[model samples]
Target: MIPEQRRDFIYRYVHEKNVASFNELAELMNVSHMTVRRDILALEEEGKVVLINGGIKLNNLLKLELPWREKAELNHDVKRKMGELAAMLIEPGQTIYLDAGTSIFEVAKAVAASNCFNLTVVTNDFSISHYLMDMPHITLYHTGGLVEKRNRSCLGKSAANFLSTINIDVAFISSSSWDLERGMSTPDEGKASVKEMVLQVSKRRVLVSDSSKFGKYAMFHICALSQLTDIICDTALPDDACQTLAAQNLKLHLVSTEREQNHA
Candidate 1:
């Protein structure tokens, strides 16, 4: 395999396992021990991993971002609640923008199922467009630009420029991580640009995320909680964080898993 592909494999393997032994990596890659050691040293210089006794551990500071596929499998139940609640907030004949993320994807699904006719849905996510495209009542506009295969979305200046020209009633945005201090953040600058542009152009901005996303910040800053019109998250958010959001006067919508189960 090429160097980038090899490093990506090693990164994913170590990230999934949290820590990996030198022997394990060498065997997995069918490479010599020295070759594996060299690769590990290289990753260390990039601040992606740390060498320990006989193994390497992922850099905790740099572990803030997970690929979209891995992230989609997490917090499914919480995302469902957030999605359902966000869908209820929308009215018929409204133009909406669904930002690229798993939680926002759920919102797209919810909007589609609501049978809301003459709805204009704009998205950069291939999954969301695919989900709503066939519905006759919904008009879908996908922003095309540089494609990030892992996130399965388009980003960069072209996508952001397209969003700027349109009038969005509400935009459902999400990120790889968020913190009270850094606000919303993502690993990719291109993705951050698209999200920032969406927030700037939308009439009402709704941040749809899970509680676990709190207290984590990534490489690029999207926007602070205070900038959002509404924040929708699961109830697992800490009391302190809730207080912070309240202090900022941001509209906070917390969904309870228990309530959803009971209602079901």
Candidate 2:
């Protein structure tokens, strides 16, 4: 197997077993111990696993969603660049859906700052709705349901039902955790249902996320990678990860982060 495939195997193996020894993994994959070690190191760098005593284990941190304020602060710059790239896909007269998340909030911010006008913005995020509320040129609609105050979003059967009725020109979706194997996922089924509905009703589906979210998994699956038409992320996304997306024929945009541009 190629390196990417090997790493994916190691990831799944560890995830299933909860913890895996280097010797057992190397034997199971029929690869050398050094090869398994190298793959484990790569996975660790992605924050998907943690090195243990002569073994590796799935990172438990990936299973929980961080609070909104914390997530907003985690990768502020990278999310801004990704949001800028995602916002460029919006047109003046089209209706769009912005999924509830900090990354999608940046997209709303960029759209509000841009020249686009007469656009209708639909969202479940309280923060996004409030951010775009004062813009007279744009029409806004909120998916009202159960308030998930932790993420500052609305979710439930009512929220998902509200999304099913509207046709979206483009939908910018966000995720706390995603990977090649599992696609986009979240810790709550409510969030997953809303996102799943958005994917089904939109003409164009775009995933706006930072590279940090890659190589991670959550408790609930939203949708598979094949469901998306485009993906916007920072250049810190690994080359092999990019190749995996490219091979699937997804439109991938790797924007340069502010830090990278400033250093250049």
Candidate 3:
């Protein structure tokens, strides 16, 4: 099919479902996943639909995107709620850690919006640091390391080593995938180990994730649900998974669906 035809199909599919996954679009247009992805990329450049995790959704033009990758788009709603809950745990003057994830950006937003000024934030995500820059009272410390362009974060042995030295009050982590039976995991081994180090130095390790992470596994395992002191998530999470975490004595903080979020 021609590119014009494919573009039309993309619009049609998105209009019908409000979301279109790469695989679904490929099937509809009888093309390859790479073709679909390329089309989505072109569309994104054209200011059309926003390409998310294997999918596309109508763009929210008003909000300037904060260097988000496709990997972070799967559970957008769940991430917002988790961010709110994570923010509530932060107290004034506390030292906190925020990992590089879309959900974690929400945590950054919540913290920045609050009046509390006596907190130090350590982060590897450039966007998170950028978001907190205007907030006068928050002290920002970045992990000095090689920057990963796709995720827009610092990751390397240097970054991991830097995190090992800092003792923090609480660390809010985000992951791409999780397995209750196995552990929390991520696609990049270097970044996964960075998360592990962040948890090690923090007094309270809070896992902030969405329901889409459940039942999935990544190449590198970070930490187990058992290792987390608590988890914050939205209502889309499965009850069975929650029960599994509970059996491991992990405290689960379920966020209310009604909590307001800064939508994308």
Candidate with the greatest lDDT versus the true structure: 2
- Alpha carbon lDDT at 253, candidate 3: 86
Tens-digit lDDT string for candidate 2 (1-264): 999888867766664456899999899989999999899998898887899999998785575565677677666877888888888899899999999999999999999999999999999999999999999989999999999998999998999999999999999999868899899888788888899999999999999988767877788888889899999988988999999899886799988867788899
By the TM-score metric, which is better: model 1 or model 3? 1
Q: How do the predictions measure up, each by TM-score?
A: 0.78, 0.78, 0.74
Residue 258, candidate 1: alpha-carbon lDDT: 55
Across 110-190, the per-residue lDDT of candidate 3 in tens digits comes to 888877678999999998998888788899999979888878899879999999889999998877567776678776777
User: lDDT values of the candidates?
Assistant: 0.84, 0.88, 0.77
Clashing pairs in 3: 93-118
For model 2, name the residue pairs that clash: none
Give each prediction's root-mean-square deviation over alpha carbons. Answer: 5.0, 10.0, 8.1
Error of 2 at 190 (Å): 0.5
- Report the C-alpha lDDT of model 1 over 61-156, residue by residue, as the tens digit: 544466778677677778887998999888889999999888998898898889677889999999888888799888899999999887889999
What order do candidates take by lDDT, descending?
2, 1, 3
**Clash count list over all predictions:** 0, 0, 1
